[model samples]
Target: MAEQQRLLGGRYLLKEKVGTGGMATVFRAQDQVLNRAVAVKIMLPQYAGDPTFAARFKQEAQAAAALQSPYIVGVYDWGKDGDTYYIVMELLHGTDLKSGVRSHGALDPKKVAQIGSQICGALSIAHKHEIIHRDIKPQNIMVQPDGNIKVMDFGIARAKNSHLTQDNNVLGTAHYVSPEQTRGQELGPTSDIYSLGVVMYECATGRVPFDGDDAISVALKQVNELPVPPSQINANVDGDLERIILKCMEKDPANRFQTADELRQVLNSYLAGRAVDVPEPTRVIAGMAGAGGTEAMRMGDKTQTMVRPTAPGDTASNPVIRPNNQINTSSYDNEKHGMGKGKIAAIAIAIVAFVAIAIFAVSGFLNGGDQKSVPNLLGMGQEAAVASIKSSGFEPGNVNQSYNDQYSEGQVCEQTPDGGKTAAAGSKIDIVISKGPKPIDQVEVPDLSNASDLDEAKKIIENAGLTVGSTTQEANDADEGKIVDQSPKAGEKVDKGSKVDIVVSSGPETDSVPGVVGKTESDATNTLSNAGFSVNVESGGTSDTYAKGYVMKQSPTGTAKKGSTVTIYISEGKDTSSDEVDVDSLGLTGMTAEDAEEAIANAGLKYDPRQQSSSSVEVGNVIKYSPGGKQPAGTVIILYISTGPSE
Candidate 1:
């Protein structure tokens, strides 16, 4: 994952891989320009070469970036860097609901309701824009530390008005896929509700409602089987929650919650301990059924809505069996029961001759025919692509519009019967044109009054798609550095990237207390008083190292309100040493050496005696003491006695 550390889009510096999914790997990256951490989902290398994958990747960005909700992961930016496609999003610091459920068994009833409500809120926003999150499961829901939920991964989401052709492969996990999705039919908001029901089922029961040995078996179960009531698996599950789950999982979309807002209202009623309005399920059977007309039933819900194909006796939902190009002749053979053996042989020989003639005609057509490969028209202008298709002996079919961020407006982003595929002359090829980047909604300013500091306010503004503008200082009594007021007041809607100016509290009209720790007491007092602060002096006691009468310390050194008191501590000079002796009046001329030693010791001084020849005093007697006055307690005193006139 060395590529994870590379700078993408010239701004996002990926740090490491956070997760890997089927189509992309998510990396925790740093937005160097904004100086914030974000999650960057990078498309896998295998999908880089695929134009369809590229289109889907861009579609994800367009769908998610247009939606603004607290419960949805915010998409900041998206673009292509060289061969890699990446989407930058808000970095979440919690585990997904699937992991949370696995680590800790079933969740509490109230908590499940709350989480479901938040998810509903997010889905409500997407649904309002006609976007349907085709895949909704616990794996795509993040449970934050503060108990908030964030729904993620709108990669497969498509708008209700989107004209993109549906693919044969299912887009969601089998256990959570709705009946329509399992049958590869058109999807709507109800499909997401169905998947959400599966999520709640797992949350309440600590297990998925449907599981099997293989994906196909699980998918088949999703299409045909009924789920067990959550209360049966976990007796603690209340009837209200169970009803909500069952209603959402109803076989018929009409029987389920019609809109996300309706589901949210139901969840809110449950949370508020009020009676919920649950609709009675109707019995509607689909093409697939149990033996002998047995009804697929579940506790407290007894309805089935069977989605039928175009014709009767069509079991197209059976994943194991598929319709083949070769026509079946069994029905025709069954009608010939009464025919004679010779007649049957003659008929078989005629069929063989007819097949041979058809093969011969096809061979001649292939040997010399007007056929050509469909040229790649993607990235070309719509008019140009249509011209190219016609010039290549092919007819241009219907043109559809889809939102794509990578391709410019009116450019051909996708074409059916893709490039290089062999098509017969004059065949119609459909194309999808780009509508350019999706429109993003205006951002509302978040309340910044609770911001603890400037940095926090800046972060809040930036996260809301606004920038921190010029800051003004105000005097607020409560918090010194908190935000006092903001321009374009909180809750006011402004264009994305608009500047929001803020006023910060400097705390009661304050000024920075001047620094005067080493100045004399008078000088410090003068400086403090001049800066609009009242000055007070305190004796901080003597210091052996500091000179007398200098300011040694101060209180409120950084800042204080005007006229607030500033306390300066003045030094009282060096402390006296208790062992020092004052010997200015001591007499040593008549004292003998022993007496002098005793006197010095009594006075806290060291004595050293020297003998000298002298007529005025006897030998070995103290005649003089040198350099002894106000010395430390360990001062040494030298006593000299005269030694009889000797040089």
Candidate 2:
């Protein structure tokens, strides 16, 4: 059967498959009961047959449904129709972060921080629910059309108290897994934080920190290797953002941001242009020393070697230290035969110190001396600043521009180091030139009068640095779908990013008017009112074919403007023709204004008309009348007329 013909749980009508994963296939489905579009995820047949996997799938739905956050995908419902287990979720419409990053390389530092902050929000909610989102990579983050993000695919996530444990094997992708995850250890929120750090790293540098030909190699790197700083890969990555990302990627869980919320706060601070105070990432040295006694190592500027002490009866590896043509060990061996142990140790220390001093002397000679003080560059012209840096024994580095309130345009506003700070000679000095004070954040509202349709109007609004607000349709003389009016009218100045509301033309306000002949007065009025037409009632000549309170005639019965009046005439009940008709037996229970007028005329009595707005009475109809019974000839009857509902 076609997907459109397949109805699951007798309510969801599958429309078409939208996506597929290793464990389940997602279909865009229509909810029959709610009449809304939803995404239905059905487990693959292979996984559905396994009782253990099936149970976990069900738990995934339960745990995800318990989480409620705008940054988190909403889980509507879950169930099993026969052997098929399915979950209904909110249908999303946007590309994933991984695809976005691949198409467009590394993002701006602020944008990366913004995306990371939103993911942190989602993680914060999940952590509060005791659920750890083991996988937090770009592939699992959806970049929405509005530039926000939604964390997706909590497939492997489980609550803390869940019976199932994934400690036996690694569960997430190797390139983004934490060290503890690679070791199959118990995971927590910080583990997710570690993965998030890797995600931000990839976003900032356009590539994962660790990648290899196989998963095993990558997993090993996750445990044993340290990631290069993001700034080293992308020059745009600032020091603050680099620290934040590195802190989240710390190998030790305790060293990472303690919680997702804590990380979000720091990110928010960075985005707001406030000072961020994150500690430098901890650096660890792996495979430094082996078992047994410590080894002595000596490192020069160009060559270094570590010699392990030889132990008796130990046959591990060689203990001798050697560097090509740099050091001679034959002299030590020849002198050791007659020399005491103390003498040999003293000789080794002297050799190490001599190598260090020689290397230092060579470095000083090449660089033209010791450390030099960085010169003051603030408020100096770009050319002057560069000349000063050269004269001060330093090289000019990256020269960037930024808006600064104190410094004039083209003048240096900032430098990496203070004027008196000591830096190595010939080191590069980075400076920031001023672009003057920031401009006011205001924009002129776009004129939407010439827009052809709503879509065009939206584009115009957005192009003008404004957002589209609520749109309303109103009957207008302009062509249908055209924008007839706009708020904050054209050319008006407003704060940038303000919303502009628009009114769309619905064309002429004409509709088919229903025929109400021979219907009760109340029924006829209601029919007209519901059709967006007001009703007006008038007395009609007596007619034997229709009852007293029934409509006998109507005007403009076909099409008419909405909210316009439709006139209806009611019968006077068989034209009694008696000069003094008995008012008590007049049968005017539901008589319209027209019916009442004819009846009063037939009974030889005059009526005075009175009109007022009413809520319970239809327009142009009679509400009530005085002189109900036993009225004499020429008696003036007061007839109350309804003028429709009040505003």
Candidate 3:
């Protein structure tokens, strides 16, 4: 039973189990530092008790760790605190490929190829490391809703040339196992390639290459059966791809593509809108030689020799049968052996010179001249540090710039392999450059009121790095074009791409033009401006009909659109005068009067100071006249005392 109160790993705070199976249990755990979701798979204690089982399980996780492909689930870390061995992997957001197939019945060829190509790409990385993902089946493939496929459950995977999986058990889903893998024989990249082919065939046909009523029966078909043509099940499958799948599912391992890349390349070609034709493998060795009367067994130890080191060097690199004493070899067996000691022994005086020459050839490196550790240059600048890394036999990768409030500009902020971690010395070192702290941002609008004027407020809002939805009108007491509402309300933190909505004013209260027949141009303009409208003034000659500066006419009179202009005709106060009015004099004065009038023809003024009054001298002007104040050119000072200057 799983521990209810506590989990195996002290680091991961397990909430509840997300999934469980025969070999392991998957739990939803919170990664403390990264603060990201991860799936932790813990091996059952019964399996962990067996050394071989435990080793193979760890190998499965390690092999997956070495592979760097997006299609493969990312293995973050693996460890064993007690009897619990667990691996942390990316938590996916989709159902397994099995569920997808069950839901859709069968996938189209293009869709099969699209997912298959990515699967092959992932397997290629593992194959390059001489590792085989022994368990390859639809149940182990995750098909996300976005249509991307992720290969999962590398827990049963085994590295080639390793003795871990020799535990002698049928270690994979029986329906999809390769022929050689089913027989527990020495497997290689071709093993995975064959399995991938079986998966592709199943994806296209909705059936495995070989299936039976029982596990043993299915295992038999893997060794002896030929898969049915995919086109027979799914007519949409391309004939070319069907042929490729058959070649991949060949019962004989030797008759399969030697590498997953080969399978991937053919599928890639199909996806690229090109025809693909994969040639059959030339070699096809029959059933496994496992205890089957094969003469391949070694007598004892492929090539064995007694373990004894040369003594401290004597003198000559190689001398006749005298163990060199240049270095003490006796104590070496009690300690750790290394390339340095082997190289120093190469110069010893040995019995034969030929062996010494071979030893000299191997001195530069213990493992084929490979570096073991990245150099440390933490405090150095970019130019010098990159130069130093290159000199140390490692490649520089990804010079990323990040904000560093403390570090100087162009200074290295961080590096991969950190400080003391021993990475392959020739491997790449990814470093982060300091870009200082992020720039201080300007204020952006969050919650905007519909009452705000949108067009008028656009400048203020945009200058603050905010987003606004399309302008709309609402029955608001406030002016139009002002902010109404916003998403991600104000003071709510957002990086960018936030949108806000607002409303704007529609103009002043509109009424049918109030009869302005008696109002002046000034009054009309003020009425329009105050009412949120504008006015235009036009003047025309009067027929002695109306007063000057009064309203003449308006378009759609008294019903003008709010904020629209109104044209008004104004009068100049002109009229014809009667009763002894001086017409000729007033004509030159540019003024017309009615009733009683006084006028100046040009360059003079006249005055009329009476209505129905009797005048003595010159009744038109001198009778009742004012001096220099009327429209006439000349005027006589008319006194009621018989044309006197003054009374």
Task: Give the whole-model CA lDDT for all candidates, comma-separated.
Answer: 0.80, 0.83, 0.64
Which has the better lDDT: candidate 2, or candidate 3?
2
lDDT of 2 by residue, 330-437 (tens): 132333566765567779999999998787677667767677878999879999999999999999999999997667799998898878676798889999999987
What lDDT tens digits, residue by residue, belong to model 3 across residues 1-647? 44534544666666578888768888888776667778888888789898877887788788888876667898988899777888888888889988888888788887787677778877887777877787888888998776778898877777656776465466788888887778878777777777788888888988776766999988876775445567656767755777778778776666666677777767666654446766532222243321221111112233111111222331122222422332222223324656655656665646357675565456535556564456675556899879978987788988888886545677776788775445565689988877755654545454455334555566555656765443334333344344544444567654454434444444334566655666777887786668666677777556366677676555447565566677767776655432233433423221223222422323333434443333333333333334323333244433221222332
Off by over 4 Å in 2: 2-4, 166-168, 285-647
C-alpha lDDT of residue 435 in model 2: 99
1 versus 3: better TM-score goes to: 1
Q: What is the lDDT of residue 221 in candidate 3?
A: 66
Candidate maximizing TM-score: 2
Cα deviation of 305, candidate 1, in Å: 16
**Which sections of candidate 1 miss by over 4 Å?**
280-647
* Estimated TM-score for each candidate: 0.47, 0.51, 0.43
